[model samples]
Target: MLSVQLFHNFNKYARITEADFGLIEQVLSKKFVKKRRTLLSEGDKSRYIYFVEKGALRSFTVDKDGVEHVIQLAIEEHWIADLYSFVTKAAGNINIEAIEDSEVWLLPHHELELLYEQIPALERYFRQLFQRAYVSLQQRLNLTVSSNAEDRYRQLLQDFPQIAARIPLIYIASFLGITPESLSRIRKQLFQ
Candidate 1:
């Protein structure tokens, strides 16, 4: 059942044969994370890349003031990992936590390398995925630097309407680089 989302995502990039899917399944392990559980913590090495099959997860960092800044949110069918740590096996700066009780498929680095070696197409598939991720990150950074908090909030709503309904306002505010009170004000102004 979890493979359904994985297969659907992979199909967008490459034709995944049933045999390919079976081989891919062999390398994946399923894990359930409870809400608010930390899957990866700051200064810990990220050994696995997670694919969300159900529920939500987020990556964030706390500032010196101890304020949390959300970096990314991954819901169903999305992938989340500290890419630098995953690639270099270094301690990560971000923390990944489950925002809700979740089911995830984990692909270990070693198993991923083996799959890449055995199935060359898998390498290309991941490269495309990374390229897209890079572009999205760049676009997000652009928005963060150029847009006002209210505009950013609007874009967030336009992009992920489901998020507002599912996630708390505090988290959404942090993701927008605004205070929760500011978000409340903005929503009031927009709605009223």
Candidate 2:
């Protein structure tokens, strides 16, 4: 079931042999998470980088006041992880949770290191993936700093087309760094 997409995703970054891909398939484990499931809780050292195959997930942090500030959102075909914890083996500050019932492909970081040596192309593929993730994070930070709330909201919709419909507005407000009431106002204004 996950065959074509996984293989296609790897080949999109680098030409991979079937034998090499078979190794990757062996290490990957799939699971279905119900909505609101927490894949990685805050303070946990992450062992896997999850690839969303069906639904959506988000990474966020809760403030002292119990309010969540979303850091990243990953939809189908996208990857999500607490990179710092995954790479350094330290506890992570952010929590990764499912927004919808999601089918995810879990790629173990421990196996990935071995895969890199066995298949040189895999290293290139992962390197490219990390670079792109970094670039996206930087761009989001830049947008948050430079753009107004409405512009940020608009950008979110443009970046993730189904976000406004599939994701809760409160999560959207948190992602945009705005209050729920303010987001409601913005939506009202946008339609007028």
Q: After superposition on all CA atoms, what RMSD does each candidate show versus the true structure?
A: 1.3, 1.3
Q: lDDT of model 1 at residue 98?
A: 95
Q: Model 1: per-residue lDDT, tens digit, 1-192?
A: 447889888878877777788889998999999999999999999999999999999999999999899988889888999999999999999999999999999999999999988777788789999999999888788998999888988988898888777888888898888899999999999899
RMSD of 1: 1.3
**What TM-score would each prediction reach against the true structure?**
0.95, 0.94
lDDT of each: 0.90, 0.90
Off by over 4 Å in 2: none
Let me know the TM-score candidate 2 reaches against the reference structure.
0.94
> What is the C-alpha local distance difference test score of candidate 2?
0.90
lDDT of 2 by residue, 1-192 (tens): 355777888888998898898888899999899999999999999999998888989999999999899988888778899999999989999899999999999999999999999999999988999999899889989998999999988888787878678888998899889999999999999889
Residue 54 of model 1: what lDDT?
A: 93
